[model samples]
Target chain A: MSVLRKIWTALRGSARELGDAVVDANSIRIFEQEIRDAQAAIDDSKRALTGVMADKMKIDRRLAELNDLIADDEASAVKALEQDNEALALEVAQRIAKREAERKEQFEIAERLASQIASLRQKIDAAEKIIADHQRELSIVRTTESVQKATVQIVDNIAAQDSTLSSARSSLERIKARQQRLDDRLAAGEVLARESGEQALDEKLKAAGIKGEAADANAILARLRARAES
Target chain B: MSLLQDMTLSLANTVFEGHRFDCLPISGEQEVLQVQVSGLEEMPIYVTVTDTQILCISYLFKKSELKEGSINELNALLLELSLPMPLSSFGMVGDRYVIYGALALTATAEHVMKELTTLASNAVDALQTLEPYLK
Candidate 1:
């Protein structure tokens, strides 16, 4: 009976430890998703920044060429006007002035465009930094999670060990209970035999003005029965 | 006219209160004018001065959008310095005016209010420096 009880106790302990392990596994999955989302956002910002910079460079170069042409044309018109070629001077001056006006307009347009480009670049840079910061945060979170999981696993192992010890302890208690019950029955039988043997002695002692047994055998038997029932 | 000095004095007036400007001293012949605004969040306002006007080329703020009242204050300030409201004909690319201000994004009254304030402040400060050049 003791051997059968030990086997049942071991099975129950294993089942309880397995339940704890399943719970720990689920928590790790949630941490992994958070990391993935952070990484995706960082990638998107990088792509957008790259496209913006490329376009800005092209516009800048175009503006620079326009600026150089305006300068060259104005200088030529001045030189032509100084040479006393009235008709040629007027045409050159007018053409240079028109181009200069166009260049000025283009310059203003370019300046505003450049300002907008710079602002966007700043935002992209800030976003990129934020993403990097989040990545670092994710790393720390993941590391902490891993350590927690390890700790849980160690705790679970300790719990499993404790469960086995508890099972062994319970089996011992059951055995002790069984032994106590058997001992009570033996004691009852001995008491009955002693009572029968002492019946003659009791009648003899009654003449000497003393009771045969001071202790109540029936009361002791009742106590043993109550203990066994409990 | 030294473009650098003109811009620096303008920026100094806009950012620093009660700072008397003697004259803008030119450091070198460069397109970029770097103005240092001293504070916990030290902002560097960059300016590019041209023949016609001074453009607040770029400025950096942490993450918040600019507010409209702030923009109005900036415009008023720039008006005091004779700088006009920056034209929107400027195309945006990266952290350019449009993107940083979220100009291309869905426009709400609140959003516009926020963006305009910062933009106006930056433009006014930038144009203040260019005022001499513009005249």
Candidate 2:
């Protein structure tokens, strides 16, 4: 079966809950095992390919030897016929025919072995691709697990600290509060400085025997309008 | 040496694109690099490099943080959001939701840094976008 199908099967079998650590761990193990199996299958195919290649080479050598023998025998037969020796010529012709037949047989074996090697090589290439895919998937699974586990540690560490790391909402509120505090301090400082200045001005007015009332914006505007009318 | 340890050492002195990284190794069965990026210090990116690929993850929130009855709605919304988001995807690691990106093992340090930056910023964006669904 394909690695994807195996993973799908495993996933289907364990899709009952989110964050099922056990199932995820088991799936990761299965994926690793599947990758190893694929590598082994590729190795087996390579070994088979080498064996067939060796056989093809052997047959190729035999075919070459047979060709040489056929050529020599044909030449000998020609020489025998030239010398008017019919029996010797016939014998050499028969030997050449036998060598030709052997060559044909060896050539056929070599062709078969070559085809076998080609298919094996193709299979190994495909298997290698599958293994790479499996490895990629396996790493994702393993890394997710690591990240999750590490997060647990990190979160625990953070929680152990006194509000060092908090929720996003809390962090946002904290930032807002920080800015708000700065604004409040500035406003308060301005109000205090104005109050002290007003108090000193009121004391000076009392020393000069003049009573001062706090001026309102609307009252000042009414006075200005009255003066314009007059 | 482990790849995580090597990366930790190299990243210790790395200041990329105006952000400095502080790498810490999370102790466990497997090595995980917790990279705290400057400015986005709240969201740390977790990195693990395998033989085939490099995986970087930043936790957005936990399942417990979701408002009551918003799980399905949030999940659907996350699925829709994943398509338009570049270089990152949303996933759940156990109970925690994370934004993660993956790269080939041949990816350069610059690529890793880019991924980390994108992942960290994406995480903060995800939290803000999903705030309505959070309690």
Best by lDDT: 2
Once model 1 is optimally superposed onto the true structure by TM-score, how far is the C-alpha of residue A20 displaced, in angstroms?
9.0
Worst 10 residues of 1 chain B by lDDT: B91-100
**What ranges in model 2 sit over 4 Å off?**
A1-21, A24-48, A75-88, A108-141, A162-165, A173-230, B50-52, B69-73
List each model's interface RMSD: 32.9, 3.5
What's each prediction's TM-score?
0.31, 0.67
How does residue B50 of candidate 2 score in lDDT?
A: 60
| Pairs of colliding residues, candidate 2 | none
Kindly list the per-residue Cα lDDT of model 1 for residues B27-66, writing each as its tens digit: 3333444333322111223333433333332232211233
Clash totals for all models, in order?
17, 0
Query: What ranges in model 1 sit over 4 Å off?
Result: A1-48, A155-230, B1-135
lDDT string for model 2 (B46-81, tens) is 887765678898767678878989999999999999
Each candidate: RMSD to true structure?
37.1, 9.6
Q: Candidate 1, chain A: TM-score?
A: 0.44
Q: Chain A TM-score per candidate?
A: 0.44, 0.59
Docking verdict class for candidate 2: acceptable
